[model samples]
Every structure is written in C-alpha cells, then in structure tokens.
Target: MALSVIGAGFGRTGTLSLKFALEQLGLSPCHHMMEVFANPEQAPVWLSAARGETVDWDSLLSGYKASVDWPSCHFWRELAAHYPEAKVILSTRDPQQWYKSISGTIFPAMAGGLPEEGPQRDMLTMVRHIVSDKVFSGATDQAHVLDVLARHEAEVKRSIPAERLLVFDVAESWEPLCRFLGVPVPDTPFPRTNSSEEFQARLS
Candidate 1:
C-alpha cells in the first residue's frame, strides 16, 4: 500500500473534520473513533492492537486508507511500527483550550457508554490506560496536560523523520496541509468543528 495518513491527535482536536477533509481529498476508507461508535463490532480488534497483542493487519487495514482519533492515537507507536513509511500528522491547538474543551465535553460524553465488545469501547479502555502516560505525562493537572503536548511533540520529532511528520494546527487551514501532503489546495476554508457546547450536548 502507498503511504497512509495517521492522525496522532487526541479527540476534540478537529480530527473528525480532518478525516472528512482527507476523504474529500481522495483518502477514502479512513478510520476514526466515530467509526467505532457507529460500528461497535470493531472494539475487540482495536483492544488487541492497543494492548500490543496479535491482530490481523490485513483484515484491519483492508477497509481503511487512513485512521484518526482515539485508539488510533493510543496505538500510534504501534502504527509507526507497522506502517513505518506512513505519514504522521500531529494535530495541535493551545493546551489550555484543549484541556478546557476535553474536560468540559469530550471526556464526559464518552464516559460509561463505550461498548464492551466494539471498537468504541476498546478506544475508551485504551485512552484511559494511556491518558496518564500519553496525554497527562504520568501526572494529572493543568500543567500535566501541557506537558503531554510538549512531550508528544518532542517524541514525534525524535521518532519520525522530519519530512514524514507533519505538525498541523486545525485553525491554520488547508494550504500548509495541502503543501505537505502534496495534494492540490482545495479552495475552501478548513472545516472547524466540535464546539464545547456540541461536545457537551453529545454527553447528554
């Protein structure tokens, strides 16, 4: 397969919008946590992958040309191992704003609702398992959240080739992304999504 795209961004980082944009750009068959939401059956498959247990990559990667958000984010290091040549996108936003958005809405929405057998459930489990390590830097505080972003940034820089790793801020629009991906720039504003209110309402 050609180089696939992986979103290393956490939830609430405009990953959904990016997923849609990539699809519009001809990167179809992408995977996202929302896919897990819509299809609960993929949970166990994701759980095994996140735990570094054996999984059928051919079957798993068969349908998706790209993957974003949780579970995918959780297993990025693993994905890097599998698709060593795949492009990695590190989506970022201001740390405080991200924390506010996540704490207020995203986390609340997913709590206690993921299916035990499906991918969504597996994502919830995987995220919780790694939040302290990946998103919180083994600590839980406002400072820790910032630390997570910083550490993740550093890790990606160290692990992936500079050319293979792209740092994209959703607010910056498509030009930079298009340039990096070698896709023609679409004549449209980058899609902005997942307001705090919208995320909060999902919880209800």
Candidate 2:
C-alpha cells in the first residue's frame, strides 16, 4: 500500500502497541525499532538514510505499510512530504508519566546498548537530540519532561497537515485509532508490552 503511516512518537508512548493495532487494521509488516534489533545487520542501510544520505525510499520501505517509534519519528516530516497521502500519528501520554518511563527504561537502553562512534550511533544521537535532551544526559525532571512533551506536540502540530495528522493517546485504546484507519474495531483492547520494569529486568 502507498498509504504510509508514521508514528512520530517517542518510546514508552504506545508505539509497539500501535504497531500491532495498525497491523490488525491492515497495514501489515510495519517497520519498528525492535525490527532493527532483530536484524542488526541492516543497521548500516538505515543509518545511512538517517544521516540524510540519499536513498531509494520505496526500496528502503520494501514491505512496510507503516512505521512507528524512534528513527521513524525522526524522519516523519520528510516521510510526510515523500508520501502525501500518509497519515501521521503522534502518540502521547502524561508528560510526567512519559518522563518516568523514559528515565526508567528508554534512556538506559540507548546509552548503554548503542555504540557512540558509528553511523548507527550518529543516527541514534540525532534522534535523541531531536526528541529528548541532548545536553542533560538522562535528566528527567518536571520542567525538562514537560518541555520535551510540549515541544513534541507543538512541532508535530505545526509541521503536519491537519487532515493527515492524529494526536493519539494510547490510554484511549482502539476506538479513535480504528476510526482513523477506517477499520472496524477489533474485539480486543490494545496489547501492552515492554513495561519499564520489564525493560530494566531484561537489560540487567
């Protein structure tokens, strides 16, 4: 399908659950960060694209009908321009809650897991700078967290077309999401996976 959907939301913002939900809504085979992990060999190709090096968009997104999370969110503005018919879903949550989640799960993974001196490293750093604090180095307080959330909200609103953009709160579950995708609601609540505690336990 030519109809691309970009989930330009940070981690701990329901990106994974949305991936499954979108697939259920017929946009199968979505690209996500976890997929990148599963196929670490493909890191170079994606890293090149993230670095603003030219790439065949269609070829890069070979089987993906949609994409969610980190690197995807980073390139959303460009993706929207490339695919005019695409939909952009900015997943969100309470700023404080999001801050807690990131401090507890995401930042630790990024800082310790990803390398700091290669294409993948540069790409990840770029996304982190755009989405979170580049200077603070894992600081998540009331002011900084709110700042991140607000900036994310503002930038997405200003950059994307109204008709194509949907600000989604995962707490609301499947109704709004299904409606946005023009699909019937499934007989299921959104699946929650990868909790903050779970992430910590896995990494530890």
Candidate 3:
C-alpha cells in the first residue's frame, strides 16, 4: 500500500512515539530506523539510496503505511512528491531540547564505532552518510546541530504546501494529528517512549 503519512522529522523528535501512535490509529507497520535493524536485508537498499543512487521507492517501502525518522526523513522530499495524497508531518520541538535529546541518544550512537563488516555496520555507515555527512557536515557541536535542525524545519515549511503539512510536536497530544489525518483520536493516551535513558539502554 502507498504511504498515508510521511514524517519529515529527525530521530529523537518523538518519532518512535509517532510510529506507535500511527499504528494505534490503524496505520500499522510504520517504517522507522528500527525497521532497518529488524530487517537486515533492507540495509543494502538504503545504503544505495544514501549513496545517491536511484531507488525504487515502491519496492523499498512496500507494505509500510507510514514512514518516519532517519533514512525515511532523509528522503522526505522525494516521498512527498511520490505520495501526493499522503499527509506530511514535520515533527519538531524547541531547538535546544531537540539537540539535547539527540546529543544524549542518537549522536552517541552514530559516534560509537562498529565492526568493519556486517549489516549493523553497513546500516551505521549509511546513517553517517545521510545524517552526519549530509545533514551535519560531520560536526557534533550543539550550536551547529541546532542550526541544522532549524534550517531543516524551515525548509520543510517552505517546501511543503501548508494544507498537506502539519508542523507537530508530540507534546501537543493527539488532537492535531488525528484532525490532520481525518482519523478519530484513540481512547488511549498517546504513546510516550524512547527516552534518552531508554535509548542508551537499547544500544548497550
């Protein structure tokens, strides 16, 4: 099935929670970085995409109803073009808070070295190329990273049509998201997950 939602948010921006929320709202099988780790066979396809090679987005993302976080976020423009009917969610937060979350979680994960071979290393390499090299220019300084974050949010706002785009913060709860997607808000509370400490534990 085609993507119903395209999340143009970086990691640590409540993407994991979004993934879960989407599933709760019947957008099951949402794609995220965790999907890559779960399906090692998908690594090469993404690595090729990271290298600027042509990719069959349909073939790569088949079966997923929504996509978020890295890898997908890196290709959000293309996805938005491809799935014109899909709603784009630009999940965001205060720049400093966003930087702090990633610094304590995703940044360290990217900086942590891996073995020279294997799917995990390959996936990390692809992430580095897209996130570190392309997005951050291999810089980890807080100010620089926050600047990049601001620029990305601004770019998303400028690029996507206002009607189809929703600038969201997970803290806003489910009303806006459900309204944007024309779906009813679930009776349950919003999924709160993947905190900095939890992320570190997962890596460890």
Specify the poorest-scoring 10-residue window by lDDT in model 3. Answer: 106-115
Error of 2 at 69 (Å): 0.4
Clashes of 2: 0
In model 1, which range of ten residues has the least summed lDDT?
131-140
> TM-score per candidate, in order?
0.85, 0.83, 0.97
Which runs in model 3 stand beyond 4 Å of their true positions? none
Model 2: per-residue Cα lDDT over 1-204, one tens digit each: 554798888777878888888887788888787776665555666566655688676776778899988666777777888888889999998877887888878666666455757656754655455445433335656587667668867999998888888899888888998888787999977867777877788768
Better of 1 and 2 by lDDT: 2
Which lDDT tens digits does candidate 3 get at residues 46-112? 8788788999999999999999999899999999999999999999887888888888887788886
**Residue 133 miss distance in model 1 (angstroms):** 7.5
Candidate 2 segments exceeding 4 Å error: 1-3, 113-142
Q: Compose the digit string of candidate 1's lDDT tens values, residues 140-198.
A: 56676667777877787788788988888878888878888899989877776668886
Best by TM-score: 3
TM-score winner between candidates 1 and 3: 3
Task: Give Cα distance to truth, residue 130, candidate 1, Å.
Answer: 4.7
